[model samples]
Target: MLIDTHSHIYTEDFSEDIADVIQRAYENEVRKIVLPNIDSSSVKKMLNLTEQYPQICYPLMGLHPTSVTEDYEDELQLVEFWLQKQKFYGIGEIGIDLYWDKTFIKEQTDAFRRQIRLAVKYDLPIVVHFRESFDEVITVLKEEMQPGLTGVFHSFSGTLEQAQQVVELGFMLGVNGVVTFKNSGMDKVIEKVDPSHIILETDSPYLTPVPFRGKRNESSYLVYVAQKVAELHQISVHELARLSSNNAERLFRI
Candidate 1:
């Protein structure tokens, strides 16, 4: 069995047939799909999906880095409310994203630290969104480092050094469809990392793997990613699946 540690199929991308998507995920042995909330706009839909399929869908709450505007505190407050209200696998989909716009860097940093504090307080892992800002993300994480800080860098695409640093800091590297891309350069990175520090994810409705490239990604396609990572580690696909799933369970406690 496999667990898709990060996927956004709940974001209207699969609204028409999310059930079918979940079915396909289960059919492909993607037994669990973890959904991360983007902001206030996504909490209800994310919760609804988890409620609809309690056993298969798990929910995480956090403000995404891209959503870090001047009013990010409002969103963070809502995230806090949700955390206090119910159980979440982690505080996630949170981190620095200097890719799309660099204007809100300070806001994003503040939000990231606050959320990290929340994760520490809640005794939950964090799933980070470090897009085009790996150094920035790592810096903040280092500054806020404490006894129980742990999380995953979603859709991790970094060098062997960076991967080593992440694992050293007690974070698992979330590998996904990008690992299967023909020219993404993620394969070389994945090959150097130890499988014990790796976890599987699709980041679906986004980075669809090869052969299924250019198509809307879903949890079911994680197998293609699994196959690639397995090849990189010189292990069987099933073994990779078991190892990645175990890593994810340890990180998310799901």
Candidate 2:
């Protein structure tokens, strides 16, 4: 079964037909989807979705980097409180993103570090979102890296050397629709990284795969991403699905 490891189906983008979207996911053989909460505002919607689809949906709790602001401490407290109240598969959609704004770079770093500590505390893997700050992300991961500290760097678009660094640190590279993009450059880097170190994701409601490019994305489209991976690895789509699904299970333990 294919797993869309990082999707925000709880977002307003899917509110109109969330059930239909999820149904399509199942129909397309996307057995499970892991929801990564963006911030405090999404916590309610995220939890609600998990409750509604306990078997097929799981939630990851963490304050996203873009949500990191001056009031980050309060946000962290909320994250910690909720995480303690229930079982979440991971600590993420967390990490640094300097592409949108650099005003909170320091704060984002602090929040990311704190959340990583929380993951360490709870023995949960993390789902990182690194954009225009791969070097900084790697530096932090180096300091925080431990045998038990594992996770995937979602939507990885880095050089092969950087991909090697992430793998060396004991993390998987979360490949998404970007690999299908003609100019992504991820195709070459993914070629170098072992399939075992790669996991598939849709990052849905965004980054739609080719043919669906510039259109709304959903978990059902994961097949296209898998197809691309299969072509790149010279393996069947079923093999790619099995490998990536196994990788997801290994990292998320779901």
Each model's lDDT comes to 0.92, 0.93
Candidate 1: worst 10 consecutive residues by lDDT?
A: 176-185
Poorly placed runs, candidate 2 (over 4 Å): none
Model 1, residue 49: C-alpha shift (Å): 0.2
lDDT of 1 by residue, 1-254 (tens): 99999988888889899989999999999999999889999999899899999998899999999988999989999999999999999998999998899999999999999999999999989999998999999999999999988999899998889999999998999998888878888999989988999999999899899989999999999999999999999999999999999998888888
lDDT of 1 at 2: 95
lDDT of 1: 0.92
Model 1 misplacement above 4 A: none
Count of backbone clashes, every candidate in sequence: 0, 0
Collision pairs in model 1: none
Least accurate stretch of 10 residues (summed lDDT) in model 2? 138-147
Per-residue lDDT of 241 in model 2:
94
